[model samples]
Target chain A: MKEYLKRIYAMLIYLFLYAPILILIVFSFNASKSRGVWSGFTLHWYSELLKDRQILSALYNTILIAVLSALIATLIGTAAAIGIHNMKKLKKKVIMNLTYLPVVSPDIVTGLSLMILFVFVKLQLGFLSLLLAHITFNIPYVILSVLPKLKQLDKHLYEAALDLGATPLEAYRKVILPEIMPGVVTGMLLAFTLSLDDFVISFFTTGSGVSTLSITVYSMARRGINPKINAISTILFVTVLLLLIIVNIRMSGNHNKKER
Target chain B: MKSKWLSFPYLVWMLIFIFIPLLLVLYFSLTIRTPDGLVFSFDNFRRFFEPIYLKVFLRSVYLALISTVICLALGYPMAMILAGNNFKRKNVMVFLFVVPMWMNFLLRTYAWMTLLERQGLLNTFLTFLGLPPLNLLYTQEAVVLGMVYNFLPFMVLPIYSVLRKIDRQLIEAAADLGADQMTIFRRVIFPLSLPGVMSGITMVFMPAVTTFVISRLLGGGQFTLIGNLIEQQFLFVGDWHFGSAISMVMMVIILLSMGVLSRYDKEHEGGGLW
Candidate 1:
């Protein structure tokens, strides 16, 4: 009886979490615009969703920013993690705190301050600023994930590679890079997800002409409910679900390999 | 060694992006642009102390606190269950908990809008059941619901992780002693889980307090939380000094609370952003 009750409890929580999203997904296929009444199924909203120029551009912007920021943040963060791993105690602590500042602070402050800095420097607040903001927030996560892997690495592994007559760059590329590859990959994937989901920071940093899918959705949502958002969000949801599954599979595979 | 040169580039990037930008915000908050020249003053913060803005500040904190409490109440039991020794399919259950989080945050919150609309599913179900429909949307309850719904995962994930890490031996040993299940849980389990609970509170509270979107969407623009006030200062009024001042105040509130929380978090587990 106790076990049955536990199962029921878990089920109710899951129901609460998933029911709204499932409803929205179901509505995306509804032929009629009515939200409460489920009309006959049709793919009209998804079809309409594709032809919408503004949403398409926003989608393009979201993907472009997410991809570019993830790549750049991974590169910088991995290098910085290695360097920090070799640092003395005090210096490491200071750098870590500096790293945590952005991570810990509220998004509004980060967003607002970045806006002020961009305007002060006369940098345009469009795609470039948006990309910069994403990269800025992303690097800390990448650094954090990468640092743990660096700690696990055999500290002498690089020296061994060098003593074997490989140059420093070659040693780093062949030895250090592979060892931390899992962390780097996780960080990159996380960065991509965060950039994809980010709205508040993007809302402030992005200017009039260029907007992300989030910003577009916000404007549409503000005006009231639109079925088009449902269509776009469904596609986004599926994409993210697939990504998470791929990452999960890959990580578990790596774990099994490590066990072996 | 020489590899430390690699961090040089990142340090430079951090200085430009993190340090300077925050410094600029501080500068804006402290200074007023007069006709003659920019002058430093506390006028913005002074104005913030007025009752109208104070009410917004207090409301933001009060609502965020309520939401955090609700998340804790709901999430704690779920975490305990998932972390329990007899729990099977733990990994899958945890994964299921995370799956909704992978959905877009905006869409997740917006999902509630569909359910809470006057002509939406909740009312439809109510009518079908021969019950009175609720005017659910555009209310304080809706905003609090949105916060709890969105941030529930943040609370659960941290607490679940911490509970998972608690050694089973400790509980077994407590049982071997004179402790009952309730005693083992209260004396052994709960204390060990404080770190997770602390981090959970911070994670949920910070976001809930700062959120402008949830309040704006669910409150139907009727409620002006601190976030809305700050956004309006920048968006419409173009009042940077006042906006930046409010932002600074928000940061201090968060920082002070975090300091207090971390002081108690001796293990320092799961507090930092992952």
Candidate 2:
């Protein structure tokens, strides 16, 4: 009886988590415009989604920013993690705390503070500003991810490579890079997802004429009752689901190799 | 390995982007512009202490606290069940918890809006069962529901990670000592899971306190939390001084609470951005 109750409770929690999402996916296929009522099923909304110019542009912007920012952040953050890993204790602590500022601070403060800095410096608030903000927030996650792998690396291997007559750059490329590749890749993927999912920061940083999908969704939802958002959301949901599955499989595969 | 110069670019980036921007917020919070020049003053912060804004601040804290408590109550048991030996397919269950979080958060919250609306799905279902309709949407309860729905995973994942790491020997030893199930749980399990619980509360409470989106969509536009107030000042009212002051105040509150929570999370397990 107790075990049965536990199962039921777990099922209810799962229901609470998933019911809204299931409703969304179902309603996207409804032929009627209203969300409350279910009409006959149709693919009209999905067809309409392809032709919605504003949403398509927003989707393009979201992907463009996610890829660029994640790549740049991974490069800089990997290098920084190595450098910081080798630093004096006090300096490393200071730098790490500074790195944690954006991570720990509330999203509104980070977003608003960045907005203030841009206005103060007279920088234009569009793609450049949005990209900069994404990169800034993303670097910390990449650093955190890469730093752990750096610690786990065998310290003597690089010296062994250098002593074997390899140059410093060659030693780093041959010995160090491959060792930390998992961490670097994980960081990059994390940065990508964060950039893609970010709403609050993007909402504050972007100016007129530029918006990510989250911003577009927020505006549409506010304006009330748009089935187009449902269609777009369904697409985004599936895309993210597939991406996460890929990431999960890759991560677990790495763990299995490590265990072996 | 000792080539610290590789970090030079990142350090410069941090100084320009992270450090200076925070300092600018501090500067704006403290200063007022005179006709001649900017002068340091406490007027912005003083204005924030006014009753109207104070009420908003308190309300934000109150609602966030309630939501965090609700998440803890719901998440702790679920985490325990998932971590229990009897549960199979735990990985799949954990993945299910995460998949919703991966979906666009705005859309997830918007989904709630549709369901809780007066003539929406929940009400329609209730009517079909010959039950009275609930006026749930656009209320404080709806806002709290949205917050719990969004942040419950933050509570669950951390606690589950901690529970999974608990040593089987310890529990068995407690049982061998003739402790009852309740005693073993109270004396052994709960204490060990406190670190995860601490981090979970910090994670959930911080976002819930600072969220304008959930409150805006579900609490209706008439409701104003601290986040909504700060947003209004910056976006619509164009009042940077007051907005920065509010932001500064929120930063202090969050930092101080985190400092307190970090005491319980000494090992710093599950501190990653997941």
Runs of candidate 1 exceeding 4 Å displacement: B267-274
Candidate 2 yields a Cα-based lDDT of: 0.91
lDDT of 1 by residue, B89-146 (tens): 8788899899998887889888888889988989999999999999999999999999
Q: Provide the clashing-pair count of each candidate structure.
A: 0, 0
Candidate 2 structure, TM-score to reference: 0.96
Candidates' C-alpha lDDT: 0.91, 0.91
How does candidate 1 score on lDDT? 0.91
Off by over 4 Å in 2: B267-274
RMSD of each: 2.4, 2.6
Worst-scoring 10-residue span by lDDT in model 2 chain A: A223-232
Q: TM-score of each candidate?
A: 0.96, 0.96
Chain A TM-score by candidate, in order: 0.97, 0.96
